[model samples]
Target: MDSFEQLIGKNINEVDLNESKTFFIALLEYDTKHCGKRYPSSKYKLADMDYYDLISFSQLFKKEAILIVWYNMDIITDLEIYYLSNDFDILFNDYYIIKKAIDNGLAHKLTEGDTKYLGASRLNEKVPQPHSDILANKREFVLKKKYLQKIIDEISFSCK
Candidate 1:
């Protein structure tokens, strides 16, 4: 696998899940009305999930974790995510846009799908004027022994 460090203009690959002492997951709900558009928090809800599979995985590998769930639309920073993942030793964000990051192979496509996660009306809330910082919502759950299942779930559930 190509080290995401090089893609992010970093000299070394720092994506070591084992080294992560803390794991953070940010979830941002999308607005159904803004489907296929920039998902702003104005018309969406934001909340945090108590636990996710990544946390357990990190713990299994002797890593501490923390997951954060935010609502609405927020910019997806690919480089930041890649670095954060490795730095934190946990894969929290970037699953949805991993392909884009891999295909782009450059740091310029960071904002390609800024609003791709929008149109998710699971929350069903609409605000005409949304806050500018509301970016993306992440939904995560826990997994037992099936570690690979997490990737499969992301590809099937979030990547779709």
Candidate 2:
């Protein structure tokens, strides 16, 4: 569906998970929009998993649409989780959203339901360096702020 770039813009620098220590895990469960035909991927399997593995596994299975994990980046990025899976080679994380629905609350509320693990991704690893995460977070916050201001200006002009 929507790439992070489309939703949040590419103004934010992609964090180097290999270096950052604060990590967030986004668990994903794809909704089946078609009739029959099970996907080549599993819904909720938690084994030693990591960001890169998510990237690789998605490429292999090609069934999962979005990788949904928790938004706790301060704790889960340094892990190479796929090492624990029976077939770690089949995981991937393309077009994933790092932010959580909790950030959206209300209409965009994060369901902390039991179905979370069922369609949720686990954030079990952390970025190796917290400093890296800090930089990424700052960049994202600033970019969003600027985007909001631009939208406000456009609306004001239209009303005038």
**Best by lDDT, which number?**
1
Q: What is the TM-score of each candidate against the true structure?
A: 0.18, 0.18
Candidate 2 per-residue C-alpha lDDT over 4-106 given as tens digits, one digit per residue, 9 for 90 to 100? 3444444223322222232223232122225522121223332222222232333323332222221122222122222112222212211122222212222
Q: Distance from true position, residue 57, model 1, in Å? A: 7.9
Task: Identify the candidate with maximal TM-score.
Answer: 2
| lDDT for each residue of candidate 1 in 1-160, tens digit (9 for 90 to 100) | 4433444354322222233345433232333242333222322212222211222323322433324232332323211121223323232332334323323332222332332221111222322211223323333222211222232233333321
After superposing all C-alphas onto the true structure, candidate 1 shows an RMSD in angstroms of: 19.5
lDDT of each: 0.28, 0.25
Q: What global local distance difference test value does model 1 have? A: 0.28
User: Alpha carbon lDDT of residue 133, candidate 1?
Assistant: 30
